[model samples]
Target: MAQPQPIPGTTIFDGIQAAKGYALNKMCFSFNDAGNRAAFKADEEGYMARFQLTAPQAEAIRKRDVLGLLAAGGNVYYLAKFAGILGLDVQDLGAAQTGMSKQDFKAMLVRANEQVIH
Candidate 1:
């Protein structure tokens, strides 16, 4: 099978990327449990260390930058779980990705949906 061509400024969540992101993904998945989320909030460093995240992944989590996390091998689905802990939703991440305010990104979503509907 041919490998998918890499997109500029994008991280493709291929098998290799998934392997690299395992620890980060595991940590994010733990957020599905409210107790784990509370534990992470109680001591972020301890939680990160428990997952053995790579340095870049740790930094991305610290900054709460969705793009950085994606670049560091985070899957969007898993990151969404993590974002919930920070009171952020996927729309916030979308806004950050597009360099727009949350309002603008939400508006873009609405426009796209309207186009599809019409």
Candidate 2:
């Protein structure tokens, strides 16, 4: 019998997929309704307050602080998407157990972004 292989872009951690789903849901919800989009756009401060992130955490995200997100238990793929939404670049953290380098993960992210746009 042959061992099963992971899907081309799947990560080992299930939590990472959950986090990405959650963020995508939030983004879609925010865009699907006029009121939601207005609320998000009208009060940037209050919009962030909804996440309940600490000041430093929010600041770190704003600064594209990959180290901080890692310290906060953020999944790198999800964090990259968050950084994308924030107009920031995702920095390479290192390699995964599957021998996928951080650069490979970033390229996967770019592909994911293209999928989202399409």
- lDDT leader: 1
Task: Write the residue-wise lDDT of candidate 2 on 1-118 in tens digits.
Answer: 6645776633444565456334333543454456755665676567657766556555654665555555444566555545544544444444332345778877887898999999
* lDDT digits (tens) for residues 1-118 of candidate 1: 8879977767788888898899999999999999999999999999999999999999999999899898888899999999999899999988887789999999999999999999
- Cα deviation of 44 in candidate 1 (Å)? 0.5
Candidate 2 pairs with clashing backbones: none
Quote model 1's TM-score: 0.91
> TM-scores of the models, in the given order?
0.91, 0.39
lDDT of each: 0.92, 0.54
